[model samples]
Target: MTKDEVRAKWAVAKRMVEITEDEYASHNVEAQAIKFVKTKLQIAIYYLSQLDEHGSSYTMPFTGKQMKEALKTPITKQNVKDAADWCHQCRLIRDKACATWNYEEAKTA
Candidate 1:
């Protein structure tokens, strides 16, 4: 997603988080449903973070030949292990976006 789109999704997720928290606090039932929704929202947030605004996925830190080889290989545990650093970078970017949004909201509040 674009930066703007990411920010918008983060805002929506924040609102949904608040709503789900309130729902859990106010009701005596359906806790599982609320938790499930929150989980899905979080997954969406992270998945989107791995894509650029143009919707192309970010690549791992590899040479062109390595990237091609990796693509040809089936996804395995080793692939995820190798991509940990890239994943961490993406998570940091996502967190920064969310933090900037929260800071802006805090200023207004």
Candidate 2:
């Protein structure tokens, strides 16, 4: 996913929750959702980092993988894929091109 796409998705998601620039400044409900998305993306990126550290060919049990391991329930590839897709849908990550965080564009009015 590209960065721009992620930002776009975030914009849409924020709108869906009726979050505006003013609310974000005040740290209101919409801001909370933004925070959730940011945290989720951060965790996903950390998971990707762990995968990189472990090497691409290495396949640990889903239960052993740091990201999956942290989950209370079993984490499947489909689960990660779904979350990743959600991030893309929320414009949190780009589905194509480069991945980036469009904080300025997404947060600004």
Candidate 3:
């Protein structure tokens, strides 16, 4: 379902005394999707700020503290950490999926 639909369901669920299984699932999915989107956005901003040096794994490039400071909303440190962790997990998953080495040109990498 679309994010807006999920959000509308969640809002209605919040007003109910007892939520159904489907409502619970919708709320859960919405929460996870929100976090995933936020993490991706933060990842993009964090990496873009690094210019070309971000490719080097030797350095952290930017820390969670820096990200928090860079944010305008004054979010908590835990939120920043969680987003960074989620972004790192996404990166690792992509790398693992590409580990089959099925590419036609390996040297180009």
Which has the higher lDDT value, candidate number 1 or candidate number 3? 1
Per-candidate TM equals 0.33, 0.31, 0.31
- Writing each residue's lDDT as its tens digit, candidate 1 over 44-90 gives 44544434443444443334343233223343444444344444555
For all candidates, the clash counts are: 2, 11, 0
Q: Return the candidate ranking by TM-score, descending.
A: 1, 2, 3
Better of 1 and 3 by TM-score: 1
Candidate 2 residue-wise lDDT at 85: 53
Question: Which of the two, 2 or 3, has more lDDT?
Answer: 3
Quote the positional error of residue 47 for candidate 1 in Å. 0.8
Lowest lDDT block of 10, candidate 3: 49-58
Model 3 clash count equals 0
lDDT of 2: 0.39
RMSD for all candidates, in order, please.
Answer: 11.8, 13.1, 15.2
Task: Candidate 3: give the clashing pairs.
Answer: none
